[model samples]
Target: MKKSDFRYDLPTELIAQHPLAARSASRLLLLPPAPAPLEDRAVRDLPALLAPGDLLVFNDTRVIPARLFGRKATGGRVEVLVERVLDGNEARAQLGVSKPPAAGSELVLDDGTRVAVLGREGEFYRLRFESDEPLEKLLKRIGRMPLPPYMTREPDAADAERYQTVFARAPGAVAAPTAGLHFDEALLAALRARGVEFGHITLHVGAGTFQPMRAEEFKDHVMHSEWLNVGASLCERIRAAKARGGRVVAVGTTVVRALESSFRDGEVRPFAGDTRLFLFPGKRIRSVDALVTNFHLPESTLLMLVSAFAGYERVMAAYAHAVRERYRFFSYGDAMLVFPEREGGTDATAHDSRLH
Candidate 1:
């Protein structure tokens, strides 16, 4: 489909800057198909909206503090945004500077750590540092959390806590599973108290999650890859949930793509690898009954994916309603609960078990 098909007016004012005082306080726009219900409710009212047997599949990928600012040996200012950590003290990153620093050049960080430019690794720069600490530990000490470009402000103390989900564990993502941001400990507890089962999977959301579609046609776009790991235990849990006729609700598009990527011959299996699965209109959804996601930028892949799930007409109409209702949009904004048409390629019964 053409990227233009997803175009809509998103006023700059509607893009949320900071999160609400309470996560669950975010508004929820629920969209079901014809004859189904569409409710404009607060996220805190989730328990009442979902069934007791529903399985909430959450992305546990942790966002890394990948933004780092430093100066070259010649005192030129530079910023290194780590795209992917290769190993201990090794990473492929975007080097922002007045000029491209060449191989064998030295980058002196503000923390006094020296990172040497090994060479170019594809579109990213390969950097090597002399440090005994592991990559994660080194990042914690010297790197800053990479906030989205929209924030208009740098990462502060509050972001270290607010930017992460309560269930975050496996570390790799440059961006957090944003939809999961709406759920706090108290809200999760409430869901569990009402018999909602939680299942965990890993899909490290790379910078790709935020990259816009420059191409008009989605088929012309080359998706950036992100690593994911779906273990057998998670598969078993989802399968069991299906057997009992429960819904598989993905917390975000990342989880949805990861779960669908794990499918084979119309069945889900344990999967661990990088996926560049392009989700647009006409793509068949193997798993994922419902989605909980943040509103996205206009004419982007995210909007297209949600449109595919929620139906193009319904999603566009719902977005118009979201703007009219004054609901916040994007990252720290509000959320949406979308139910895909179950009768076509994706049936509620087809996803009764083994959903990603």
Candidate 2:
């Protein structure tokens, strides 16, 4: 498939710049099984839609305050978006500046912390902090929320909490696993009470997630590697759920990648490393049965992955419906519940009035 196959027109007004008052207040668009009517429900209605024995796998990778503003040694302004923290005093980042800094040049943070540009690692520059202070501590003190490019406003204190999920534990991701942002403590408790089991995986979202697919053919696109950990215990839980005939519901695309990357020879095993898995049409989705995700950007790899999980045509129709109904879009947007509908499914073309 060509990269343009996933293209869709999205209205600027539909892009959500800020989050709702409450996490569960965002709307939920349910893309039902083919030939069934689509359902418009609030995120709070998620529990009722899931079965008792179903397992909800979530990405627990926390969003670190990765945006840093600083000046080059020549006093020119520079912006650094941390991609991965290597140690307490070193990291890899994407630098935004008029002129790229050379090795041995020092950049000064607004808070006066100094970072020496070590060298380039592909598209990112390796940086070493000049202080003994932990990188996390410096970031917490001066880094701003790494909000999506679509959000034009500057990050505020509210974004520090709103952009992150309540269950976020491991700190590493530059971007939030946005779908998880819809679940508040109350909704999680509600699902637990209804007998839904949960498992956690970590996939530190990188700044590369925002990069657009530059290749003409979809297969030619190079996926950015991200660190992930799917432990043996989680695999065991997934097996138990499968044995009991329960659905393996992935909470976000991150969770889906983490789980599916661990699948080998019909078995999902423990895996800890970087994954470059690029899901699109024709790729077999052996791990996840259902997905809970946010509306993705047009023509993005994320959109392609969702289309691969749900039929491309059906997903396009759902996007159309979402636009017409004025459901929010993007990172802080509404949620969607989609089941797999392979491309050649008989009912792929069926239209339902409920979508209107």
Candidate 3:
């Protein structure tokens, strides 16, 4: 499919700048399997929308304070966004400055800590901290929250809490799994009381998630790689849920990607590695029966994934309805509950071939 196929018209004012006061207060748009009417509801209504035996899979990767400000030894100012921590004192990062620094260039942080540019890997630079302290500890002291570029204002103290999900524990992600952000401790307790089962996968969201698709055709695009771990325990839980006629509901796109990446010949197996899975129209998604995700940017890969899960026409129509209803868009925005698309007025069956 062409990249233009996923484009939509969104007003600038609709971009959400701040999170709602209450996490569960955000609106939820329900897109059931095709032919079912869409329902307008709130995040708090999620427990009622689901059944007793349903499984809700979540990405437990936590967001880190990965943005840092520093100066090149040449005296030029530079901003660094750590993409992934490689070791206790080394990381791969993207640098923003007037000019790209050569390999081996030294950078000085505001706190007088120094970092050495070891080398380059594609679009990221390998950086080694010169401190005896681990890089993670240094970030905690001076690094700022890495907010999405679409958010105009600077990250404030409130963002330290609001930008992270309540259940976040495994730390590594530079970006939050926004869909999971809607659930608070109270909401989670409510789901548990309703007999909903919870499963977790860790997919450390990379900064590359925000990169734009530079290719016109979807076939030519190369998806970004993100590290994920799908445990054997979660796979067994998913199988048990399916046996009981319960749905596997993914909390966010990250969960969907991780689960799908672990799926093998009619089974989900344990996996621990990097994945470059890309989902678009025509791909059969066998991992989850329903998806809970935030509104994505127009013409983005994320939008295309949701369109593939739901029908393309249906998703576009829903986006139009959301725009007309003044729904907020982007990272700090509202969410949708989407089910798989049926073909020829019947349920679509999974194909044998794996999708990349």
- For all candidates in order, the CA lDDT equals 0.84, 0.88, 0.89
RMSD of 3: 4.1
Give the runs in model 2 whose Cα sits over 4 Å from its true position.
342-356
Global local distance difference test of model 3: 0.89
Q: Model 3 clash pairs?
A: none
Candidate 2 backbone collisions, by pair: none
Which of the two candidates, 1 or 3, achieves a greater TM-score against the reference? Answer: 3
For model 2 the local lDDT of residue 323 reads 93
Per-residue lDDT tens digits of candidate 3, residues 31-89?
Answer: 87666677788889998888788899999999999999989999999999999998759
**Model 1 agreement with the true structure over 127-240: per-residue lDDT tens digits:** 987677787788888888888888888888889988988889988888888999999999999989878899988998887677777788776898888899988998998888
lDDT of 3 at 33: 65
Please list the residue runs of candidate 1 whose C-alpha ends up more than 4 Å from where it truly belongs after superposition: 35-37, 342-344, 349-356
After superposing candidate 3 on the true structure, give the runs of residues whose Cα lies further than 4 Å from its correct spot: 343-356
Question: What are the RMSD figures for all models against the true structure?
Answer: 3.0, 3.5, 4.1
- Model 2 lDDT per residue over 1-356, tens place: 88888888888999999999999999999987775767888889888888777899999999999999989979999999999999758999999999988999999998888999999987899999888789999888888899999999998879999999999999999999999999999999999998899999999999999998899886677899899999989999998987876778899999988888998978679999999999897887778878899999988988888888887899999999999999999999999998767533311222232122
TM-score of each: 0.94, 0.94, 0.95
Once model 1 is optimally superposed onto the true structure by TM-score, how far is the C-alpha of residue 19 displaced, in angstroms?
Answer: 1.0
Query: Which number leads on lDDT?
Result: 3
Using TM-score as the measure, the top candidate is: 3
